[model samples]
Target chain A: MSAPVIFDPMTLPSDDNVNAYTFCVELKGGEWFLQKGKMIAYYGRIEFNGIGHGRFERLLRTSFHSPLHASDWVVAQGSGKMLLADRAFDVNSYDLEDGNLTIRSGNLLAYQPTLALKQSIVPGFLTLIGTGKFVAASNGPVVFMEPPIRVDPQALVGWADCPSPCHHYDHGYMTGVLGGLRSLTGLGGTSGEEHQFEFVGAGTVLLQSTEMLMAEQATGAVPHEPGVPGGGAGVPGSGHAGQGAAPRLPGQLGDLQRRFGL
Target chain B: MLAVDMSGDSVKAKNGSMVAYDGQMAFKKMSGGGEGLRGMVTRRLTGEQMTVMEVRGQGTCYFADRASEINLVSLHGDKLYVEASNLLCTDAGLRTGTTFTGLRGGATGNGLFTTTVEGMGQAAIMSDGPAVILRVTPQYPLSVDPGAYIAHQGNLQQHFQAGVTFRTLIGEGGGEAFQIRFEGDGLVYVQPSERNTIGGDV
Candidate 1:
């Protein structure tokens, strides 16, 4: 067998991937926001501080806007090259130039402090705006597709510059009584692809090669105020009105009861 | 997966790890890792147990365990310190023993002792993903997350570094509050993925 390549601090790649599952970020008196417990190893002198540290109050005000996610993020400072990875998943870095991208919170590994990170209005997702590089991990290699596409929810990693991202259910398949019965009970074979996240307008949609999602990170609880989606009050006059009642079973018609005007 | 080619010789491997063989081979269970009574008692006492099997044959044998990625480490007299679970296979000529690792092993949740491999031979280790081999020099020491550390070789001194402070008590601790600092001349193997170590959360 050929000798395995040994990496020294000088040979380690800067702001690039050492392998498919690992990314090396070089910090030279700069800072990077990293998710908790994602760092594997590092070289040189580097210090990791929790986001709530007093010294980062000013930095947090400008680059971090998600108060709920404060506990999940930390800041790495000093001069060194650090490796980032998550559960052996395929990790890749994306460069954003004055652009905005919304991604699942758990998929994000680390990002340059130049980009502002805020909790997405979509609940479990987070949004990054401005310019800089961010690293994300997916179950498989990410595939980029154009908008006007409907993607499996589990397969979707995120979307960039997309104007509208709405849920799309096969209206024709779930209209009548028979259709509703099939979807509600999985009787007569449900296609399992009845619902998808539809993206329109112009932008790039990122999808993993597989449909398995990474474990979701807790984004903390949003305020229980009105006019806020997932704000604990539930959607007003929507199918979620009964969500507070003991949780619904998978094949139950809990939400579909609203469709029947019951 | 690791394929070992032998010509009427023998190689010691993790027990029950052999998946396939292309030629004739005889497998024998090595009680106490074939290290005799003293090694067995030491391993049992240290909690660094290794159930090894010796495979002797004139053909090629394949070994695998739990679908983990296998990495090859060549030893030319220096000692290799690895977790018991990460060791896959080693040449029959090498001597395997147990050593006390102190706080570093406890922090990584691998007990307070580790397995050591010595002699001139090639050994195969396993990791959750491909392991990155890093060379540590005296000038530039390396600090690795305890959960990601798999193994190390050469003359290196490791210290369990904890950055816990008043902030850590308030739940605002740096996620990487605990690390294993390796200094000296050696090669450290770190997996791309981290195991759930006892000190992972802080």
Candidate 2:
């Protein structure tokens, strides 16, 4: 067998992938915001500090808007090249030119401080807005598709520049009493593809080759206030009372009585 | 999967890792990793026990474990130090032994001893992903996270470095608190993913 290629400080790629699973980012007295515990190795002197570090108070004010995710991120400062990876997943870096993209919270590995990271309106997603480079990991290779497409929810990595992203249930699976009963009880054959996330408008939709999702990192709970999507407050009938009710499985037809026109 | 062709030779492999074989092969359980009594006693005392088997008279034998990525390392009179759990197979001529690793092993949660392969021939090690071989020189030392480290070869001195400070006590700590600093000339193998180490959270 031939000898494997060895990487050193000078030969390591700057801001590029060292391999399909690992990415190298060179820092010249600069700082990058990285998720905690994603760093594997480094060639030069780099210090990883928690986001709550008193010195980064000014930096967090300008670039970081998601206070809920503060505990999961860190600031890598100083010079040298550092490698980033995530559970051996396929890691890729994308450049954003004054654009906004929303991605699953757990898929994001690291990002430049130039981009402002905020909690997305959609629960369990984070939005990055600005011009910079960010690294993300997917279970398999990422496939980019145009808008006006409905995709399996499990295969979705994220979407960019899209205006509408809503749940799309198959018409046959949601209409009649038989359909509702089948969906609710799984009495008949359920293809497990009855629901998908539909995207419209002009943009790119990112999908992984596989449907397996990375473990979800807790992005922290949203505030309990009105006008919040998953704030768990202000909804009169669907408050904590819903938590006490029987757990509803995904694709379950809600309010069977109402569906029967009772 | 790794396939080794043998006409009338023998190879040491991890026990129960043979997935398939196409030719005549006699498999014998190597009591105490074929290291005899001294090595077995040392490994048992160090808590770095390894169960290996000797496969002899094989045409083509295949070995695999847990669908992990396998990497081959060629040694020419040098030594390769690896975790016992990551070692898959090695040539019959190579000498396998356990060595003290000091604090680096403890921090990685792999005990205070590591398995070492000496002499010539190729040894197969496993990693969570393709292992990145990093060349470490005296001029450019390398600091690696304890969780991602798998193996290393050549002449090297490793130092267990901790970045824990007062902030680490109050729930605010650099996620990468424990690292192994390597100096001298060697090749360090790091997996693309990290294992759960004792100091990983800090």
Candidate 3:
């Protein structure tokens, strides 16, 4: 048997991955905004405080605008090298130079405080803007694809450069009444690939090799206002009680339209 | 997979963990990890129970469990502390026993006792993924999430640290509220994945 490699603070890489599933971030009295519990271990004197801490009020106001997710995040400050990992998933770091990228909330691990995090207009997603490096985890290695491409919803990690991402259904599968019925009820053995998230214009799309998705912690609901996607109507306590919490599929055109063959 | 070669020497391994063997082998169930009657009673009381079998006279014996990654550690008299479930196999020269871990084990949801392997030999531990071994020194103390901690060795002082505050009661607690701080000189083994512990959600 061979001895395992032992990493010390001096030997640990700075702001890089220790292995496929582990990333090490070095802090020289600097600060990092990390999702709660993503920190597996750390060396040196690092302190973790929730976003609600009084000392972090200014920081949260400037970079962390998603109050709905305040409880799920923490700020790690002080000098030390910390390690981050997620459910044994592959973790990679991306540097955004004054660019914007929207990612599935559950995949994000840690980011430099120089970046501003906002709740994306797209529900269940968060957008990071400005310059800095951020670590994200994927079920498998991430694949970068250009725009004008369609991707399976579960396989998509995020998109960069503000690509126009919208739902697309295969015309060959949803062309007629029979096709609509087949898709709506799966009565004709509908293939699960009938719908996808289509990206057009410019920018790159990130997709995990596997379709397995990370379980997302609800980032709370969007504001109950008209003209907002996932707003009003079916939201709980909006007088639409009993409608259930199951989110509407992207390509879904409502039960009424599908039933009437619209 | 862990391959153990023996030329009449014996090794203790988790029961039923041997997957393949080449050459003559004798497997004897070591009641209470071969620690004798006292060790058996101690294991039963501590609840850190392990069913180990001694494999002797083997050419090359392979051991695996659930396809988990196996990490090999060579010891030279220093004791190795690990979770019972993570220990795959240990050389016959090593001695295994149970020790109270206080609140650290409670925070990890692994009971209040932990398994310790002492003496000079090689031991194999299992993890959900490959484990990262970090060194803790007097100048650089280490803090670890209880859920991801697997094992540690050398002279180290571990203290269960809780970050709970008034905000925690108000539902704004950091998700990493429970951690174990290790000071002194030692190597801490942390898995790439975390076990579901009680402090995970908060």
In DockQ terms, which candidate is top? 1
Q: In terms of lDDT, which candidate is stronger, 1 or 3? A: 1
Give per-residue CA lDDT, model 3, range A88-190, as digits (tens). Answer: 9999999999999999999999999999999999999999999999999999999999999999999999999988999898886656657666666778696
lDDT of 2 at B155: 92
**Better candidate by TM-score, 1 or 2:** 2
lDDT of 1 by residue, A1-262 (tens): 7889999999999999999999999999999999999999999899999999999999999999999999999999999999998999999999999999999999999999999999898889999999999999999899999989999999999999965899888885657767777877678998889889999998999999998889999988778776566676566777555556254533357546656778
Q: Estimate each model's TM-score.
A: 0.96, 0.96, 0.93
lDDT of 2 at A181: 85
- Which 10 successive residues of model 1 chain A have the least lDDT summed? A242-251
Q: Identify the CAPRI category of the predicted complex in candidate 1.
A: high
Deviation from native of the Cα of residue A7 in model 3, angstroms:
0.9
**Runs with alpha carbons beyond 4 Å of true place in candidate 3:** A234-262
Docking quality level of the chain pair in candidate 2: high
After superposing candidate 1 on the true structure, give the runs of residues whose Cα lies further than 4 Å from its correct spot.
Answer: A234-262
Error of 2 at B96 (Å): 0.6
Residue-wise C-alpha lDDT for candidate 3, range B80-195, written one tens digit per residue: 99999999999999999999888898779899999999999999999988999999889889999999999999999999999888878888787788999999998999998999
User: Model 3 — interface RMS deviation?
Assistant: 1.1
Highest TM-score: give the candidate number: 2
lDDT per residue as tens, model 1, B10-59: 99999999999988999999999999999999998988999999999999
Error of 2 at A129 (Å): 0.7
